[model samples]
Target: MSNIVIYHNPKCGTSRNTLALIRHAGLEPTVVEYLKTPLGKEELRALVAATGEPVRALLRAKESQATELGLNDPTVSDEALLDAMAAHPILMNRPVVVTPLGTALCRPSERVLELLPVGPLPPFTKEDGEVVNDSGARRA
Candidate 1:
């Protein structure tokens, strides 16, 4: 098993694109479909800590229930947010990657490159048809 892990949601284009980048790097990552196999509160906390981001940063605030679930309330505590995310996994943002080098919330997909092994990558085309060159820069 590779020392890389990606919390993924296959239905999400960004997640799919990020996974493709990992494959393009000639490495395989442990894919965790968080929606299917939800992470426990503690696990979610650990993952957030690993990313050096607040719980709100890893939250999928655009989810329909985010407002209804009161997750948007500014007064909510980290523990409360974590509890909600653990109970309803959809509240959690996706495609968070952990590698030996670092952890990142790979929303742009290409952000995964930062944690990937340093090497030349084949030009990659994302779901939106944007191409990233081997140096991890978008081809102009």
Candidate 2:
């Protein structure tokens, strides 16, 4: 077992499920409530790099502020997006789990399982399950 850090938002169902999966996998993860303690610019940038995605990919596009601030506009620069995410934690995507081996975006609760060491997680049933798609819907 290695250091597993989860950037979580308890309010989000997917985030909650991801945490549950982590615990079920038998690996203790350091949960960072990103909304309470927002990530700095450097950390945010590093996370994006770790995920191998553009800065915009880490943003919560549904956030009202994202639209209010015109973040969706292609004209926005990467620095501006990073600043926005750093300033508004809600704009940062939820449940990003990082391990020494690699990092993953736990959008769908199942994705978090990939980061865990080989083990059987608690059975995922219909009741406590949600699937995240590219569109970001929590299909229960």
Candidate 3:
């Protein structure tokens, strides 16, 4: 298996863009269609841990069920959030990229660059037309 893994949602523009960026960078990553192969508790926890983000950050508060399940409450524990995410994969965010560089929740898609191996990057543009130069700097 490649060191890079991307939890992808093909229907999501951001996820598709992130994957494109990875390919553009010359690395073929292992794609996990998390919605299809929903992450188990251990896998979810590991991904969250790899990103070093609070478990809540990995939760998609905008998911319809988040509010319905009371996950919007601040008092909700990490365990509860993880459980919710495992049970309802939609509760998890999209395009989490993991690589030796680190893990990132690639919201803007370009964030995946931080987790890629150092090399000459290809010109990259996001779905929104945001340009990321070869040096990983966003071109204004």
RMSD of each: 3.3, 5.7, 3.2
Give candidate 2 regions above 4 Å deviation.
Answer: 126-140
lDDT of 3 by residue, 75-135 (tens): 9999999999999998899889988777889988877776678655867887788887766
Cα RMSD of predicted structure 2: 5.7
Error of 1 at 91 (Å): 0.8
- By TM-score, the better pick of 2 and 3 is 3
- Residue 76 of model 3: what lDDT? 97
**TM-score-based ranking:** 1, 3, 2
The candidate that achieves the highest TM-score relative to the unseen native structure: 1
Best by lDDT: 1
Q: Write the per-residue lDDT of candidate 2 for residues 35-123, one digit (tens) a residue.
A: 88999999999999999878888899998999999999988999999999999899998889987657878787778766666444446
**Of 1 and 3, the candidate ranking higher by TM-score:** 1
Give the TM-score of each candidate. Answer: 0.93, 0.85, 0.91
**Backbone steric clashes in candidate 3, count:** 0
Give the true-structure RMSD of model 1.
3.3
